[model samples]
Target: MGATPATRPTSTPRGLARVGDRVSFLYLERCVVSREDNAITATDDSGVRYIPSATIGVLLLGPGTRVTHQAMSVLGESGAGVVWVGEHGVRYYAGGRALTRSAGLVEAQATAWANRRHRLEVAREMYRLRFPDADPAGMTRRELLGGEGDRVKAAYRAEAARTGVRWVRRTYDPGDFAAGDTPNQAVTAAAQCLYGIAHSVVVALGCSPALGFVHSGHERSFVMDVADLYKVAFGIPAAFDAAAEGPEDIAGRTRRALRERIRAAGLLDRAVADIQHLLAPYRRADEEAAGGKAEDGTDGGVRLQTDRDGTVAGGRNYGAEGVW
Candidate 1:
């Protein structure tokens, strides 16, 4: 008989305390993922092994992983990002929802990103964080983009010199991974790893990855925006170091190195903090201006209170509270 949905636990799992603790996991092998007790377990040919769902940032379900609904519920509640990817983590197929229940953060994100002046300010802040020595306040959007491109090129050269890796043009064909040279492959792999990590944080923070300030239109625009901030610090150097190794399994090696670098840099936590920092100004302004007291007995915060007539209380509509 197949395993039925297990009873949801009342007490929180110990692993839940480890939320936002680790970076991500890539499940390359075929396995059956389920929930046992309060934890998640993966049963394969070897045996049943427990997976700490709460601590993991991204769960990359590559080929051959069958996840049960119960396991997914546990993961979702634990605030983990569940993603389906192709072999070697090349292509992204689908992603699950975030564990955060609050829509406040995402609403703030949309409000800031939708406003022209506010979006520009956020973009400038993002650029300023990456290049602290430079003042982006005086620069226009076009100028900022040009400056960032130039800085990235300089960073590539610096990494190449530091690692003694040959500096060549970045060439890659996503559909045909083998078409790229060793360094190019390494760079691509490192970048893919970073994207997965960044996406996990973006989802966990209850923000829309599709909505972005500096990067626009793409489904993972916000992911790209956040990942770019750490590319110079982590991805570039990792690719260079990996390229300096034996030609065999360069991508795998690069991924492993990138994982280590992510941990050392505390990237999972940093990504969450960065998103909050980038969107904080808007949230602060909204709170100060409109998120006043609610009839629900909350103060200096946004709360929804309704009367028996099914209308908002406190003599304030949703608009007055800036919640809409």
Candidate 2:
């Protein structure tokens, strides 16, 4: 379903937004003030708070997600790549919940990438198991992409198809970079930011990020579930951009540098914004179906008119949408 810590995120401060901090997760309906546990428990506007403020440090205010602490905790514990709730009722999905968190960023991203290599190896071995003549010393990311960098786009879509999930697809166009374009410094920088953003969402949504679509282990199945969606789409492009450009301009030359630079790059906020928007409708649906309320404190479920199948009439498609 996703990537593990080994999946190579584009961010530093491994597990950014880790546990033990206080949090303020603001949703369209209510604001949550609490501590960040494996799950970030929230205080509902109904004046019902299940978490203590001392454990909360992060104030996630914006058009993101709102979920029960119980749900958030699930994502956090599993090393989820991204986790979020709908406005109130639709869903509280946690991607990449089945991977390992043994290493920090450089190590983690390296591990994820290494694991990718190992996965290709294992695939080769599996093929050998059947064919008995498959090459064992062969396999490369280039081949994974059908020997063309452009094939990365297809690799992304094909992987997402496995989970019946669809995420937005993007290309790093010239429009993506204007004057002072960081192409010379983008790969590493972007990777780190992506990791941080991915893990943050994973924890919030209750998914473990250690497991993966291409790499699955028992340690972090849920985390893998989500991370896979971003690894190639977000992680690879970032890595390729910087790696493909001048490789000598940056100062620090370690993967940590890669992580830090990526972290420094902007757009985690935009990613968060996009994640929130994607989550809003689902959260609302889940909440309303269970009689959740809105910021106005009005019951939404009571008004929802559904067909016999329990699916809302004239409602936007939620489950059917796959990786974009």
What is the overall TM-score of model 1 with all chains considered together? 0.81
Question: Global lDDT of each model?
Answer: 0.74, 0.37
Q: Candidate 1 has which clashing residue pairs, if any?
A: none
Candidate 2 per-residue C-alpha lDDT over 1-324 given as tens digits, one digit per residue, 9 for 90 to 100: 444334434332234443323231222235553334333454554664444322322222222335545444443343333323222222233233322221122222233334555446433433333223335357563453343334446654554454333435543433222222233234333333344445555444333345442345644443333333344545544444344334453212323333443345433443334333323332433443443333344322223334432433223453545222
- Give the TM-scores of the predictions, in the order they appear: 0.81, 0.28
The predictions' CA RMSDs to the true structure, in order, are 5.1, 19.9
lDDT of 1 by residue, 1-324 (tens): 544445444323332544356646554458888887556888889999887666677776756889888888777777666766554427774354555444556877998998999899889999988888989997899999999999999988998898888878888776877778788888887887778778877876678998888999999999889988888889989998999885688877888888888878787777778888888776634343444334453433334444431223344445555532
Model 2 spans with C-alpha error above 4 angstroms: 1-150, 153-192, 208-215, 218-221, 231-233, 249-324
At residue 202, candidate 1 shows an lDDT of 85
